[model samples]
Target: MRRKEKLVTVQLTGLTHKGESVGRTEEGVVVFVQGGVPGDKAIVSLARKRKGVWNGFVKEILTESQNRVIPVCQHFNYCGGCSWQNLSYPAQLALKEKVVIDSLTRIAKVSVNSLEPILACNQEYYYRNKLEFTFSNRRWLLPEELQNDVIDVNKNALGFHRPGTFDKIVDISQCHLQIDLSNQIRNSLKNYCLSNNLSFYDVKNHVGFLRNLIIKTNENEQALVLISFSEDNQSEIQSIFSFLKNNFPQICSAYYAINTKKNDSWFDLQCIKVYGEDYLLTNLHHAKYCIGPKSFFQTNRLQAEQLYALVKKYAEFQGHENVYDLYCGVGSIGIYLADQVKNVIGIEEIPEAIDDAKINAKLNNLTNCSFLTGDVKALLNDELKSKFGAPDVVIVDPPRVGIHPDVIAEIINFAPMKIIYVSCNPSTAARDFALFDEAYQIERLRPVDMFPMTNHIELVSILIRR
Candidate 1:
């Protein structure tokens, strides 16, 4: 038996972190409604009812919100890549800033007078330096796009997956997030695969020529890595490699990864260099960095420079202060800041990333910086205090999950003079802010628009020991 649905008018309060509207019933039961912005009165249909939480849909927009904007992409509603497309760019920045502040206060237990002006990307579109597309047979079909042969897609360079459909993919010709070269490379590869009768990877059957496609670019240099699920034959592999090298001469590094596994693990796959070089090298500001097949580099290089500048400005180097960079990949930040400080120590979990970090340090001729490959928690335990002692300053550039609880405890125990927390996820950063509340005070919260045309934002916060 279906439960009776209840209709309610919600006075839209503000935007939630996920870009949904915050609303409540007369009984004060909180509700989150999609497609409704802040300050918009809407009639919503409650879909799910629980003890104190409710999920619903915006049945009617009773009042319009001034911050709403026309989404540029046609697949804005269905695609999983973008959430804030319907909101104005200025409004997006404002909401992002507010989210960061709220997270710090609510999660980190820290208060701030005001956040610094959000760092807006110079290029709102085509800013992503890298893109990864998944492979699947099931493709989504719109009402007008449905046909007899609409079930399985033969070949596709599907840009991204839909929100909840695990098997279905959204085939996109051009993604505004990446540069023009990515689209060109994608189109060229798709055409080549289709013409040669190459079979794309079938998620159900677990057999295919191509498993994943990754494209990265920095300045004028670009690198393309094709990850194949199974490459049992050498001749067929070399044939595709030769064709790519011959056609795309501009590709600085052309390589292939053979990942033969039921899962997405590519740890054992050999990186076969087919063309120009094994890696692509580029300069970020005054430092040089190298990128291999698996090494992680920031997607937005120009905006990254701006972010690094902010880090440098806040460091207030006395010319001999020692700095520790947690979660340092390729030692980019440590190497860049080597000259400004006495010595910089970097810690990362991945040994490959640590190897690249050391190589990059050597490439930049920065002998003062050293990278250690080990769990940050253990390093912070015995080595950090015994060998290096407490750092004069520390930089935490953690992933989306934010800093580990142990690391947070270590930082509080050590109590550095200045600490910089760089994060890709604002909510986690806000949570970590509360954890650091016992010791540090928030000095600045700056949000950088690394990924434009999407809801994702990069936030860098500077904290000082109380």
Candidate 2:
């Protein structure tokens, strides 16, 4: 007869992709706990069981890990933003390096010759250039509040969603992710809405005035604020925008959109500018980029410079190579390297991003760069090669899901002399690397820590055609 276990105390030895700690039972059954760190001996209550795997939550900390430190953020546990805040910075980098190596070795079955050390960020906190906060009518209550029977707390929250709960939000007093002004803007807006009797969005019923707030800052200290409203109230919208413009003089641009759809996505909805310019400016080395409302730019501006440096170093451009940049958003990478390359062609699926890319190229005064709007898998064919000239080098900075297999096939068919891949997700990158194992040999692998105090890591891989 098999033994049925209720609650088990196990020793955690490893970490997972989503920052969960891994442990095993005496029977060698793997268990995952959210708050467990490596070298932690904790009492966990198994909450879920499936097949041979078990999931648990930490009930009590029997023995804390050496790498564990007191998280600085007050909203560390409840907020879904940063999970590894308890772990030290050095420890986080080490674990991220291990994650990359493990995924490549285990999932891709490819042996990397040289795995360089992770490039740590100089500014860990307040490194993000962009942050999005949701306005929720249902606020998640703290354990202490529930126990003390505190019912006078304000129910409206303008902050991040609670972990594993979509409708509930944790009211954030301060967020260490973005600049301090972000907190000021969000809190002020929340107060203004409350005072003015403005209705915050209820995700369940989808009825409210305020839907979502997006804040972005550039290297020049210029700020852009974009708000989404579920209902069309021009008076309220103008009042809020005017208040922001008058109070926060740093906010150079302000835009608003009315999104009545069940979802909060404002990509398809038209945004109307109420103040200042329509776009914010960002720079990478010598190249300047104009970031529009829907443009996709790297959230970590400083680390992005280092990441692109590695990409340029690995590509080894000699001013005569024709380069093709796939999944190019705003032409940041391509424009940065255009001066050193013969000519560059960038392809992106989003039309707005392509427009920004073209505008950025023109702003940089690079006549050798061309931006095209289309699906890469459908665009990279014999005709494209004939029109744009065969690429001497190809650079791919794909999404977290990695590139489509058909797109990989097309790249292989084109057979560029060199391929530089920049990925935010290691597992998907490893899987994609496996597809190129037959034709390309891995030359260099460099991991860049774009996001500190979190489990997310970025990597740049250089492969040469065999």
Candidate 3:
């Protein structure tokens, strides 16, 4: 237990919220292993310690976990995209569910009468609807590549960023998260850029033509590719767009954005439609949405359907109730539940998201749903309640920070009969649930697996007034 910066054998027993594997020393001191799984005995380097807890990473797996399996991807060892790909699918689900239960029991000090089983995703791989890849001049070479006798000088990469490095990117050839079409599109683009002598972005120097590429798809099998360029070369942009349009006729739309900013956050960046349609059609159950290039929809489409179904089930709507969807990005949940509820008034802070929400609502021909753009903390007030009658039910699918404290208080003041809470982070959810403990009682809770191959857990809880 006193070991630090030295090799020591440890047994990984659980998984942390940040996706690190949990292990312990012989003296019962906890050690977080980066690439370890439960039932695996491994040599760890306790490189850092904080708040009396040890943090380390696996040096070698002395004994493999029974649940561990061979990763499907060749770059799984170094790629930051997946954390639990080494563990079996069933084992991953079990660990996630355990994390939720542990968080709620310890942080919220609450338990449900009906702890419904965690919902498993039907499609484990290729379930994601969207993926954002970065372009870097300096690529992180794979272990096998480094072992080769002849060292390749090509360092340009167009894929995911390395886990711990900011400027290094893993040159992904075949990512298992999205459909094979995405792979084909990505590999083709990379090949075209490399052959045409296009410069990949240099994060440190802010030089290069290609910056990022986001490939998105809908359940309808339509595809959209949005490329970001650090330099606005009109001729090059036109040529690239034309190449994609001609080569990939299956793509419904293709857009490009010129982002010269130092940071690569392109959510607010304006994108120009260079080819095909303006938007792609994404359908969830009966709700159909017009997904723009920058719209913030759930990454996993099929699992989102399952997750929303759990939300509806927890809502237990009676066909005449008014609902409030706080933090309603793109208003997909509100639109999905519009038919069951008398009215759904959603409030969000992002203007573009609200715009997308309005368009989606119009596309669905839903008159019962309305979306407003503003701070949820400031907008969920009595004036709003007067304008739109008090929400009979509040369905909150908040960001990872969970709902704000003021918003939580306002929901308590409103005293809805039922609250359907959908959360992406379990630790924050447990803390916020504790805030509502006095006003409501937990009737049931179920964890939904919106993301696989990672340690993120989505939970849906049904709270009834005491």
Candidate 4:
């Protein structure tokens, strides 16, 4: 016989990397509770062990945390995008700050002399410049709809994937992360598809015509859309594109792709443009970025500008320093600091990002900035340094895994006077700080809440040569 279900009452006190609340029982057995606030006393069900820790959700809240607040989105209970929305914005900032401090003290085991307060974002919602939606035939039923209700004949969904479920998606009526235009366009497309009998993608069998929709909005109030279809059906594609143009004039450009592959990865696929303009434009301070269909740019515009300002202030550019931007995707940071520096040389692995970087530099009429496309670890050598000159200030914005140890050794060998490290993962950043202990010392560190209502954070630290 199957074992009987067991329940535990846990006092949720902290957070995990995925935004679940961390709690403990009387015996100090740790519990990760979903739908839990930091200070909530909740009865957690679905109690199951996974890799030695208990994972569950709050079945009943005996006591509410002071930091708890009403979530703005109706689907907050189930949607995975904004798990911290129920927690107050101030509380969210505090939690992120705690992540940094804990990682440094426990993991890095280094004492930072100065750590600034977390910089809160201006907007709590609608701060994202881009959003991607998937089309799935398996839709996750709502709590109310599952109570002795029959499954509807229609099984169409066009929204985010349900948490922990790869095949099923939650049909979103409204999303709060992007502008209202995004909402209208998404809803209109879903309705039109259902009415016109265009089938949604079947993840299990890899059958159907509709696959995905991506919407990118800009500070200039123009929108760009990309539709991914399972196969190339020209007549149907034109009909859909025509419908979009007739309904939403804000869509300045549109593109569609034919993806016959099983996976949703589109970087290798070709995207055909059937609309106006080649890219979207975003003005970041003095630099105007041309964000193409596949280019990577900062999602939060307001906070990105503030973060760049911090980079400039921390570098303390003297107008005669040669700067090296390592892993600089699209050269956003390097180009922004071009005017204040003698010359800036950027290195990145992706050729497309480097192409965009060069385009952006030329667009801004910046002769001092140049970009190279190659693996940072392979390219940061004596030959490259001799060609571009030794860096006075080194700026690195690596992936979440942080800089590899080999790359760290090379940066130390360069022996730049100043180092600026921008990180998205605090834990990895802490690990990296430990590696840099001997050569450089962290002068000052600041955390920016680039993604509000979520646990994701960005931090910029200035390191001085010891």
Candidate 5:
């Protein structure tokens, strides 16, 4: 019960976000054990206590799980990239499906029969189209096994921060979860920064030049954006830019934004153009989408196409029904389904994404599609209903936090014939779905593996009138 005192043998039921096992004691104390799979009997060492939950590491695995497999990635546990690498791909998919079903039934008051089969992705690895890495001032020190022979922590720039330790960063050469271009950009930037004597950002002090690097590739275009804390010397930055342009000509657009904030997120920052063009263009089938540094796009490109296709299929538009797209980032879903419907209206909170969405609509000559910029809850209220009229079909694709209760109430109040809910977080979606349990009957649910290696998965559910 006490920290570091109880060396108990517990069975790991499942894995958590930190690649730890989900186990519970007889007295209902939750046990989170590191490096143990489901059905494994693990001897754990208690690490800390937080809000009554016990965190620990697996000192020994007394019995192995039948489903456990050898992790494929060389930097599996240390890299903080793939949490479910130890789990077989099939098992991972199965558990994700179960998580969706359980979340809906338990939290949303929906039946199992209402859910549909998960659309399994053909390719699991190297499906990512975008990868972002922060350059850390301090390199992560190796364990005692290789401590003496490790690289100097002060001199080298680290690639990604390790889990639960913001101060420590692991210098990575490659990540198999992303395509080849992602690794190339990360590795190249690290080398460039090192050679140029550009300082990497220190999380503790919040100082340095090379802050964050974001690489995005599309069917026809690729973009690399570097955000720095401060631009002390413009000529030096230009030299770096020239080298990048010469080396990676495929990068049509390269930019650098100046953000002097303490937070890692760039939601609010005055971005300045440092090089090349302004935006990155991505072609999705027949449609084209413009991506800004602040705009939101699905990280997994191939699976996103499938996700949009599934959403379109569920919409069942007859070129007459008017559609409403909630949380439409860059209007990817709205634009994709625009031709099928008479008119599509997209509502988003961020003004920047809405601007990109407008540009995308104009680029595609989608006169039928229109976008409004405002918060979801406020936009879906009386103002939206008065302006656009009630839609025939409503498509809601909220963030990981899920749809707010007020927005859910608005959806229920408006009462569209068909409701298509797309969610990245099943737990929150299920919670939000419960609010409309009385009026709408769960028609079908499909899970899409947007992120293959990690524990995260996307679920799309369609609800019909009872």
Candidate 6:
């Protein structure tokens, strides 16, 4: 198909799941424009066309929407971190609620009994407890910099990857996502590397010493810094680790890993502790958690507490009810509800997460929680149920793609009294819920804005067997 080069004016009516603004051409063709707000008239340049849908970029804002607002971040436009930052928080919440409703009704063809008001974040910016920045040799240049006669700019960047560009990174001066300590740690490391002539990772060529930096903070103000390097340079690693440890007394734990692999996945890779304890301590409600470098905790700490509260509410766990937490990462949800239920059985695929789950259960001194490591689809069978006893309530917190078909089949076979589903992706949740509509009736749904100023929203659903 020939690419559409002509610029077309569109009246954006809504926002898409990927944070793009939705509009239709005069002929009824759908167009998704990036950085376009709803209820705005924009001139968009079409970038790609496929199957009656056109993807484009906003070329000119002919009429601004009432929902539009000036973004606080200077890197809002070029950096893909916060696409909905231009829209007001209330507008963002409304659009997200609409997205969930559309996904449930239109995609899944399921009716919801009730939807509670979206739980908004108390603090919007800097609500994220974790942030990971990439080290790239070729930084993405802005439009003005590209047009400059003298193209003199620092090529080394330690920030997020540009949207739709894997090899290119945006040089961030200040990121509004995480706490102020994150910015300080990132900037100090970047400056130290640049001044010491340390190499940044060349994503295309796959060569460099510095690869990625990850910073995680908990509710208690304890921080953990993890540095991933492509090559093992002990001297350089020790120097940087020591520098961060001495400079930032708030960093309770410091770890480093040598990841020579093609991808940035270091979960399976061994992480060497360079300073302090091997794990950072965090508490939610009354339960304590030990967070390792590879641990899976919710990014938004404050909202996570709210999300877990909703999960607990939907589960409706009585003191004698046995609860099954499926796809339980680190047993956060199960452990949170351990005290309320008779016994909590947590199942996860990753062994490391299961390990963390066990540690967390011990840390909380809960003897009723049992965490098993295996695929939910394979492990959730009649034999497993016989061994673990039938669950009175089942709480599932699946990944973005939602639950597997086989897992759904297993869940149906188990047929717990109540099923509480926690989903990060609404479309997949809707689809999965549709499958359960045959045997279960939807009772209540609560949407939580765990990530503010972003298109992503978390949802909790309650289902009772019909």
Best prediction by lDDT: 4
lDDT of 4 by residue, 352-455 (tens): 99999999999999999989999998999999989999999999999999999999999999999999999999999989988987999999999999999888
- Ranking 2 against 5 by TM-score, winner: 2
Judged by whole-model lDDT over C-alpha atoms, candidate 5 comes out at 0.79
Model 4 deviation from the true structure expressed as Cα RMSD, one decimal place? 1.5
- Find the 10 residues in a row with the least total lDDT in model 2: 1-10
Global lDDT of each model? 0.78, 0.89, 0.88, 0.91, 0.79, 0.89
For model 3, which pairs clash?
none
Q: Lowest lDDT 10-mer window, candidate 1?
A: 147-156
Global local distance difference test of model 1:
0.78
Q: What TM-score, over all chains together, does every model reach?
A: 0.87, 0.96, 0.95, 0.97, 0.92, 0.95
TM-score: which candidate is best? Answer: 4
Q: Can you give the lDDT of residue 348 in candidate 3?
A: 90
Give candidate 4's whole-model lDDT.
Answer: 0.91
Cα lDDT tens digits for candidate 3, 132-230: 999899899775676574476799998888877888899999999998889999999999999999999989989998999999987766799999998
Per residue, candidate 1 scores C-alpha lDDT tens digits across 164-273 of 56666777777777777787777777677677876666767778766777787768756555546465667767776677677776677877777777765555677777
> Across residues 218-312, which tens digit of lDDT does each residue of candidate 2 receive?
87777889999998888999899878888899899899989999887878999889989989988888778887777889899899899998999
* By lDDT: ranked, best first: 4, 2, 6, 3, 5, 1
Ranked by TM-score, the better of candidates 5 and 6 is 6
Candidate 6 lDDT over residue span 17-129, tens digit each: 78989997666778999888998898889987757689998899999999999999999878889999999999999988888888888988876557788889899899988
Q: Which ranges of candidate 4 are over 4 A from the true structure?
A: 1-5, 26-28
User: Cα RMSD (Å) per model?
Assistant: 3.6, 2.9, 2.8, 1.5, 2.9, 2.3
Q: What 10-residue stretch in candidate 5 is worst by lDDT?
A: 144-153
Q: On residues 354-398, what C-alpha lDDT tens digit does candidate 5 reach at each position?
A: 999999999999899889999888778777777788888999999
Candidate 6, which ten residues in sequence have the lowest lDDT sum?
A: 145-154
TM-score pick, better of 1 and 3: 3
